[model samples]
Target chain A: MRVLGIDPGLTRCGLGVVEGMVGRPLTLIDVNVVRTSAQLPVAQRLVTIEKGIDAWLDEHQPDAVAVERVFARSDVSTVMGTAQASGIALVCAARRGLPVALHTPSEVKAAVSGNGRADKAQVGAMVARILRLDAPPKPADAADALALAITHIWRGGAQARIDAALAAAGRRTS
Target chain B: MRVLGIDPGLTRCGLGVVEGMVGRPLTLIDVNVVRTSAQLPVAQRLVTIEKGIDAWLDEHQPDAVAVERVFARSDVSTVMGTAQASGIALVCAARRGLPVALHTPSEVKAAVSGNGRADKAQVGAMVARILRLDAPPKPADAADALALAITHIWRGGAQARIDAALAAAGRRTS
Candidate 1:
């Protein structure tokens, strides 16, 4: 399945598209980052993200979307912005009736690098090797976004099935 | 000016509409909460919020929008959801070219209750008294939403002007 991965951030949102299936070689369809000026108002920054996301969804229609989940941070301001960006990504995917998956940072790291505590350089190196690229994607966020997509393609389907089974067994999760 | 205040949440989003100006009596045009089942997928939950916000914006056609600013809390999951909802509210306002205001919980309390550290009960009481309602709004979220509107009507305009000036001076804030 073709999957779009998003590393949601207010100032810089990373988008990566990959196409593949279980036990199949993955193809990097595209990778990009949409940026918004901090000088702009909060609402306007969101508008920029909305437009970029809308355009991406239209141009590169993916079967599923994967977003990095935001958790509480010591800096409330930072977490708030990340969560907002995540919300925009979720809305974009849902509007098209695409299945959305949220993977925590550690999950994505482990999926791509086989190490939950892998540093950024290590994760980037592994992503490059996995995709057989000479160099890793730039701006870290870009590679992270790709990692999220790869993780979703590699693991999300199985997890979804498990969730479905659990729900069937009357142990639904939010 | 007519202001629409949103207390953003995943399960229960509070929405309130008020009509008035600074240093004047305010009128409560409407107050309501939009709820979504936790059983739904995260993306679907966001879609529900998006629809609710879109409808409110369309129906009220408010001159401005005010939303509660989310902060870091002990409950990471809860804060994440709240922040995401805040992002949706900002987008709903920005899409329509309506200026948006974000007020912190403390700011709202200070504006409505004359104390930044006021408890929810105190804020609720003040909201009811300010709007001349028989009692406080049913849910605390509903009252908080109204309080946000009252704060914006009474304080946010000046802050926006100041921010605009700062931006023009090349000292913009995020």
Candidate 2:
């Protein structure tokens, strides 16, 4: 199944799409970074991100979407912008009736690099190797998005199947 | 000017519309809460919120939208869902070419009450008195939303005019 991964941000959102299924070689379909000026009004910046995401969704039409779940990093820091961007991605996929999954940064790192605590460079290197690219995708967020997509294919795909089976069994029992 | 205030949330989003100007008594246009189940998926919840915001905007045709800006409060830690919801409110307003303003809780408190650090009860009481409501709006958030709308009317309206003047002057100078 084709999976689209989004590393969401207000200033810069990374998007990557991968075509693959279990036990199959994955192919990179597209990768892009939607960048908005910080000087723009908050509303306009969100509109830019929303339009970019919409364009990608229309063009690529992935079956599933994986997004990095927003987490409170420090004790008290503003994550409103990131959360806003993530909302856009989730809504885009969800409104289209596609299954959406949120994978944490550590989860994506662990799935791709075999270590949850892997640093950015390590994750990027692994993504490059796994995707068989001579170099990682530009603008770090892009590479991270690719890793998220790979993680979803390897991890969330199985979980989704299990969830569906459980639902089916639940219906039969009920 | 007509103003729509949104206290965004995933579970229960508060919405209030008020019509008035700086030197006039404000009139309550409408107020309601958009309720969504916690059991719903994140995307579905956002969609519900988007629809609700759209309906309000369409029905009221407000001149501006005032949203509670997401803040990381030291006393609490449940701002992520609120931030996501705030993003929906913003995008809904922006996409329709409606001017949107974000007011900090303290700003709304200061505008409605005499103190920025006023408690919820204080804000609610003030909101009821200012709007000439016989009773305080239910579920606190709704009251807070009205306070936000009032704040924007009394505060942001002037600031928006000033900003427009500055932009015009800058263009002329350039």
Q: What DockQ would you assign to candidate 2?
A: 0.67
Question: How many Å off is the CA of A125 in candidate 2?
Answer: 1.5
Off by over 4 Å in 1: A73-77, A157-174, B74-77, B156-174
Q: What share of the true interface contacts does candidate 1 keep?
A: 0.93
List ranges where model 2 is wrong by over 4 Å: A74-78, A160-174, B74-77, B157-174
- Writing each residue's lDDT as its tens digit, candidate 2 over A1-174 gives 889999999889999998897677888899999999988988889889999999999999998999999976533443678888899888888888999999999899999899999998999899888888998788889998899999999886677789999999999999
Docking class of 1: medium
DockQ for all candidate structures vs. native: 0.69, 0.67
Q: What residue pairs clash in candidate 1, if any at all?
A: none
Task: Provide the TM-score for each candidate, comma-separated.
Answer: 0.89, 0.90
Q: How well is candidate 1 docked (DockQ)?
A: 0.69
lDDT of 1 by residue, B91-162 (tens): 989988998988888889989988999998999999999999999997998998999999998896667677
Model 2: clashing residue pairs? none
